[model samples]
Target: MSVGTTQTRQGLGSRLAALSRIVELGPGRVDPKLLTESGQLLLRAGDRLKLSADHTVVALAGGTGSGKSTLFNSISGLELSPTGVRRPTTARAHACVWGLDGAGPLLDWLQIQWRHRFARASALDKGESRLHGLILLDLPDHDSIRALTDTEADRLIQVADLVVWVLDPQKYADASTHRRYVTELAGHEAVTIFVLNQADRLSPEELAECVADLNDLLRREGVEDPVIVTTSATTGEGVDELKTVLADTVARRRAAVQRLEADLDRLTLRLAKAMPDSGAPVPLSSIDDARRIGLTDALCDAVGVPAVGEAMENVYGVRSVEWVGWPYSRWAAKLRPDPLNSLRLGDLRDEIKGLTGGSVSAQAAEVDTAVRALSDGLTVGMHEAWQNGIRDAARSRSAELPQLLSDELSEVAPRLDRVPGWWRLLLVWQYLLVLLFLAGVAWLGTALAYGVFGAGSLPAGLAVFGEAASLPWVGLMVLSVLGLGLLTAVASRNFVMLGAGNERDRLEREMRRRVGTVASAMVIEPVERELARYNEFYSALRGVRG
Candidate 1:
């Protein structure tokens, strides 16, 4: 064999190994039958190639009465293959070897009966050493009446290193079912031979027309550089040309490798059709964002975030009132509930243990709809597989979703757990203001008591921390203090309500972010991993064909 051809086969062997490994890693990604068939073919061909490096196994295949047996006998110069018009003449295969040194192991593998095989040197001239190491097989008629004959022909055809299809002048230009085999072998042009057998029956002009017509059929099948030769075994005409062609092929010693390579190409192409046409996929719009929003919305509903926000607003207002409102109203403020305490977010696991929260169906359905939309860009089968993969990814941790969400909420509760220090300052200031009012009222009561005992009429001259005691000034001081305290209470209520709004908005943003993380880690990552594996398999298919 030429060094280049040997190198090509070695490269192909490496490609096959890589493809086998990828198939092992990615089971069910393609059809199981296809995988098994390709793998078995690879192992079988590898074993055959290793058994004998020099022997070229060429199959003489043809339909009924195509004169292939006569041609086979003519080539071997012996009556080894049965020939006649008794319908199915050859039910099994007959092998002829030019040299006897190593043909036994190969013929044994081919399962040719010992009596059927012959040594070419014993029958043909001894000068035919140029065709040494040639394993020529005369296979049963592919269109034989006996089912076993046809089955044997098919089995031999698959294992043979090269195939020479023998055609007669009569059927050369006519349409026949056997022609389909030649057409399907377009990729095997390097290892295929088309012989116009029984050429002695036709005139020179008729021969030209038949060969031209057959050439056209080959061209249509994409068999560029097709090998077409004419021979007549009965008249000993053009038989040497066939022998010379076989000699040249055997001398080169590359037919077996070429045949193996062609088979790999055909199988690789068949398997490649299952993958995506393009390697670089236009990314499907990510549902990660939408999914995050959906999940966060669900979890927030379960945790009652909106309800908590409202409570927070009320708690803020209540605390504000306690800090700066009327003394009696402060006690009323103590009766209201604190929003944070009701949420049970602090040590939330034990607090909300029995909470049977769940995800909403509408949200999950929307996610499913978006995922199916991605399939519009893919073929039907690939789309189905992708959809199934996505469902598997999502359901990986489906049972833990609620608990995960609740735990995540607890982890984030600290963000909202706070009380402003300004409320304390307001409380202290409120106390001072109330004390001023009480002091004024007490001083007025003392002066009024004196007036009731005939000293109260002189109340305007009463000294009360000033040069003169005046009811108007004292009453104004008390009223102003009360009004300032009411305004402070109002301001505190608005401030606390504003804080509650800000807290809700902030928590929503963080919650959505957390939801996105969970979805990606548990779902999106797995789906992308599967996609990456498929891409690798596609690349491997290209390598195997190359």
Candidate 2:
């Protein structure tokens, strides 16, 4: 169900579920102190909700000498409660159980002694028999001399399923009673009753004035739709009316549910106001795009990808020198380090890697800065608080991020070992040309020795290079060797340059993919989880409101 809708026809099971959920939520997302002891109240109400209370436990509570006991006696039709001029009489609570046999458990729970409990079957009076399940209580005076008497009365008020506040005509508008109890119980007006107990003490006009004043006082105290009945314990003027109210309430047997429902409603109001509005549904951008550009750029800086790319270009140049340099100079080129190897990247034979060794850890600030850059775009439409929170959540795993990037980059970065097949073919052809050049040099030298000093004998059929002829044949062979070798070097340099550009593109794309993966894992998921929790909190609060 949506959070804004109220369930008017909510059943018992729904109430139980709602009440249980409030307790389950407890003080986690919200502060418990702001709850005004609601957690404790909810627990107590939940326990009460489980009981099968057939009787509507109504308490007659009032101040000193208000004739509350007299009213209780008139309702019970017996002198069960002590009444006198004695100030603040009655210590503990006295319960009157009507037409109920197993009220023992409930009375015990109310802390009323079995000795103070009395039962009336109501069969003696046919007209008043409808008050059968009424467990009317003559509570100790709330303004009692003994502090414990007032404490007992206050405790009983909370536990009683229904309450009838008895007051005298003179003290009906008492400030203490209005401020202390009545106002606090404004939420429970559904299960509350108010009575001017000593109504016969005043004339009709004065009594009417008192009732009107009491009603105004109650309204001021925030109690809406109050039921104010004028009662006379001695003259019995409004005693029957009060009895009828109890009879109507007891017949319905809904006072307990109403009381608990009011408790839940009151508590929910106190807790729900602290939450921020969810507002309209705005589209939230995914973290992927931000990560691809922002995080990847940071990683490129920290991982030295540009430096690596430059070294790769230089390594191709180094290979060129080795391929085309004079024989002695070619050996000297082999002695120098391949510029790519100077990067200190750990063995990347298996995976296409971006960062290796401690390269990522060296410039860790880049990774940290990525959060700010990425979050600037990711949380564009979010509130300031939420944007900061999301940014914090995304950067929360910055400590482990470098190592994670290193591992993931290894899988995505272009492999350095990938040499184009054409480059290898060119290298083989160069080696064979060098061999041909040496063979040509040997053939020319042998002919020169035979023609000049006869240092050795030469077979007359052998020709230098291909077929020895006039027309600078020997010079042509010499030129062929040197010129073709230089051309080969030029071709090799162009081929590697093209390969380097392709490699750079592949590496950049791979780095971006890995960066997005890491950012989602470390950043986006946590914030989204918090969002999910907020929604649940909102749902539970709504469930409780219902």
Candidate 3:
């Protein structure tokens, strides 16, 4: 990963951490896969750079015959490789260490062990004496027969703290080199340098004109005031100045650290863009919530709790008794039962579940469908939003990304909305109702027998009826009827509670799934898309810079 990419990753990682914290407090947890993808990408980018506190490795990059090796030799005062007129030379990379006591640590970090060392000549060379930390690399020809050499060059550039791109007057405007490397390194302009090598080959006036043209091209590629150095290995012209620049870069150890930090900063900005705005967290418009609430409401309407209450009153109205102490007058008092006690709300759960289709699996399926529909709607809305932004951005030169995002998002909408299976609340309610009905019947029978039989006339062996008869039979019958009604009401309330509870749980699951879909579409997927775009843009940018 290059510094720009590394920076982008760090930014994304921070935002993901923030999102993870938010999810912890949310009603549902985010999917592990989503979290893992976000974390792993950033980690991988960070790992590639071998970032540390102490050192920075700068790479020298250029096309064939760009005089990169000659420049490298001049900078470190070491003839590490042969530099001559050849179509393709420097088949391998050469590293030169200046003034550094040990090459082991720096080379080890750069994954390069075969390097040449140059010691300072004198104290008068003090301006260049501290070249110990400077590691000058002579990379293979980028436009050569060996494709792997080019790949290696790219890899080295990504790992290097700073890059010095060499270019000669003749091929300065070469399309392949500029399009492939210069434009792509836009964000790292501070850590990048473009050297107009072989300046000695041209007259002073010609050199000045070439340099001017090159600077203008760089500016167009998004590099503002790029450091343009003139150098000639053949004449030793500007060689000392280049050395001074390298020495200065070494003295400021912060350059490498700053380069890495800048990478992190840029990555952070990209990741921030990927994340949803923090103001008002978007509530999930999931199908599960919609389905659960919709289906529950529909089932309730179907079951008719009020109608059940009315029916119970009509059927059991004759069971109530009044004036418990006036036992003899009980027969004359017309008995009436409070219908509320017989209304079994518990029975409604099973009925509702059956009517809606039973089991959690079925309910889950239904919820999935509802969720899919909601997702589809959301995708359409997002597509419109993306398209609108793209058009607006295109019209305003202020927009950074093209309308490609809108088209890409629109293409992914269908996949995101794919729905999956249903689960039901009626089964639980039915079971509760059955239990309540049985208990009611038993209580009714006991009340009747004790009221008619008299406690004293009961057989001596059957003491169970003693308490049953001792209490005013009529009053007890009235109380028994009331108790049965209460039992039914309680059962009804329990049915509603259990059903609602199940629905809430399903809603939570659906909400999580919905969030995962959205996150994947908006963040992970977009990151991948942007990565490709960045590569293309960077390649073009580098070309122009060269």
Which candidate number would show the highest lDDT if scored against the true structure?
1
lDDT tens digits, residue span 48-144, model 3: 3344423446688898889898888777665666788876678767776654555456565566645443333422364355565666777777778
Per-residue accuracy of model 1 over 1-546 as CA lDDT, tens digit each? 668868977886777776676566446566787788777777777778777778889999898888999999998888888888786787888899988887788889888999888898877566388889899999888876785434778888888888999988777654553465776677898899999998888999998999998888788877887899999989889889988999888888888777877877777777766654453452343444554455445545555555444444444454455554666577764666642344445554333332213221113433344333433332234535544654565555555655665566555543222446887787888788889889878655655555333353434554453323455677788788888877877776777778767876776567556655765665556555655555566567667766
CA lDDT of 460 in candidate 1? Answer: 53
Q: Which stretches of candidate 1 lie over 4 Å from their true place?
A: 17-37, 100-105, 121-127, 148-150, 268-276, 279-407, 410-440, 451-513
lDDT of 2 at 121: 63
- What range of 10 consecutive residues in model 2 has the weakest lDDT sum? 349-358
Question: Can you write out model 2's per-residue Cα lDDT over 168-192, one digit (the tens) per residue?
Answer: 8778888888888898889788899
Model 1 alpha-carbon miss at residue 167, Å: 1.4
Mark the regions of model 2 whose C-alpha exceeds 4 Å error after superposition: 1-12, 22-26, 34-38, 122-127, 148-150, 280-359, 362-398, 407-471, 501-521
lDDT of 3: 0.52
Whole-model lDDT values for every prediction = 0.69, 0.69, 0.52
Q: What is the lDDT of residue 183 in candidate 1?
A: 64
